[model samples]
Target: MAERVAGILLAAGSGSRLGQPKALVELGGETLAQRGVALLQDGGADPVILVTGAVPVTIPEALAVHNPDWSTGMGSSLATGLHALAETDAEAAVVALADQPLVGAEAVRRLIAAYAGGASVAVAAYDGKPRNPVLIARGHWPAVIELATGDTGARAFLRARPGLVTQVECGDTGSPDDVDTAEDLARVRGVATVRSEEKS
Candidate 1:
């Protein structure tokens, strides 16, 4: 039987450092939120959920859930997303961050494939370090939400259960760098430009 996996996009952050909503930030002509949804869909995540806060964003392709406690931190957004997922038929979820526009579908697909291969927890690793776009089986959602607090998200929970995690090396598939500052955004834009030039 095929496992039903969903995509949970955390885009509720206020982006205080960038002085704007990161979800609205544009990369290669697409908003960060839009890019996130596309990546998840293209990567094979069915029924993508976008947890929004800080600022309102409407993406036709995603089921946007507003996190009223978003100001609290990434944990709140993650909790909100997980809570929303509980009502669905998803057996697992691939969590992605909106700021990480550089994380492509290939990385997400790898995580999903890992989860499909009996891995309870799957994470993308770049240069031996685990990064965003983690896959969490439904059985671990409760523990993950319990440990998810402040900006920690699922790090604490994943750390506590390192033995269950399967790391998918995706260094060549995508970059985990997030756009948290103006300089970072510029760098992403530069990369986008280079990519566009190559495609042209």
Candidate 2:
């Protein structure tokens, strides 16, 4: 049986940099949070969690629950999502970011596959540096809960224990283009447009 995987879309950032809720930003006919949810669902995750805060807003149907404590920091939201994931039949959890509206569905799938293949934590590594859209196996959930903080997800935990971390090099630039500032959003839109044209 394929182990069930949970996906946590960390969309609770205050968006101080962009001066707006990043999750609500529109991209390719959908909101950033919506895109994150879609990517997780397409990646085979069940009970995807949308961690929210700042200005509370409506979430998509696929999103399991929202964390109100998002103001406290990313750790609070991570803990909230982890607690909810513990209730579901998920064998592992993937922590994604709503600001990263361009993380491809295939990249998420690769992370999950690597996690299922016995990796404690499989993260998308782009340009020789690992980034979010991280998949955490059940064995590493504790660490995720421990190090998740202030818009910084599980990276600290992974870095603190390098031996247990698995880097899944996905040839994707979208993973690094997280929309934090107005300029970032514009850049991502340009990139998305270019990619869309290529596909056509």
Candidate 3:
């Protein structure tokens, strides 16, 4: 049997810049947190975990884990998420951002495919630039936790080992835009609404 990979959604940001918690932000008639969980599950991640910091969220489909050090930065949330995955049988984790609603399941599947093909670190790339929904093998979680601090998350660790990463192009799958401000929210909501309507 193939090894399992968990999906970790970082939703702990206070969203102070956006005037509300990004997790609760609505898009396409669903909260960002809800949408994130669905995307991860649909993309083949087993036992999806959501790391919330600024405020507690209750999403029935996901195992919600709180990061008490959320105020410190994204690194804390990443650590908390990894810690939550420690007890699971997951061989790796696919990290996704709660605010990035446009990042679709196809990107995640691609990252998983890379990991299954022997890549220890897989990252979604937009136009050749590294983006969100990165896949981190279990072997690197400890080091990632050590380097993850403030808003850096796993960036510093990933940067230190560039040769190990497998970048998968996902420009055709979806956008990596995140809603960090009211203007950004409005823009993303508009886009989401249009897409939802088209699907309906």
Candidate 4:
């Protein structure tokens, strides 16, 4: 059967460092959560899932799943998303971060393309450096969940099984800069302004 790649947006974080929830952060007119859903959908992922925690977020065309244990960190949200996707017919999932508004849909498409090209685990790479928008086949969901502790997400599992992962180059496609601190958000929002202007 062909792989059906879904999307998981980790928006559960309260963004304590940024003084609010990252998911609700506005960038160029849209909330991070809204942009996230569009990013995945535009990249061809169907039934994108947004894992919510610190605050409730409702994104259009996205399935919001509350993670009660979100206070633990991104790992739980990552596990929660995979567990939710397990109930669906999707054979794989492309995990993206809500705070990473700079990452484009092209990255997601490339990850899905990698999965279709025989990669069970793929991470979008920027200038040869592995980053977010990681794709993991359903077969490895259990391992990812088990190793996804703290804020590391699936880093432990990926590091432990390096041979099983594939890095898809996506540097030219978009940036992986995350909106973590106030300065970070301001910087990205400035870039966002430039991007919007260019489109006009």
- The CA lDDT at 15 in model 4 is 97
lDDT of 1 at 7: 96
**Model 4 residue pairs with clashes:** none
Per-residue lDDT for 61-172 in model 1, tens only? 9999999999989998998999999999999999999999988799989998898788989999998899988999999999999999999999999999999989999999
Positional deviation of 4 in candidate 4, in angstroms? 1.1
Estimate candidate 3's alpha-carbon lDDT, on a 0 to 1 scale.
0.94
> How close to the true structure is residue 41 of candidate 3, measured as C-alpha lDDT?
93
In candidate 3, list every pair of residues with a backbone clash. Answer: 12-53
TM-score of candidate 4 relative to the true fold: 0.98
Question: Which candidate, 2 or 3, has the higher TM-score?
Answer: 3
Candidate 2 residue-wise lDDT, 49-108, digit = tens: 887778665655565466777787777888888887887788998888888877888888
lDDT of 4: 0.94
Candidate 4 lDDT over residue span 20-43, tens digit each: 999999998899999999999999
Residues forming the 10-long window of minimal summed lDDT in candidate 4? 1-10
- Global lDDT of each candidate: 0.93, 0.81, 0.94, 0.94
RMSD of each: 0.8, 1.7, 0.8, 0.9
Model 1 RMSD in angstroms: 0.8
Runs of candidate 1 with Cα error greater than 4 angstroms are none
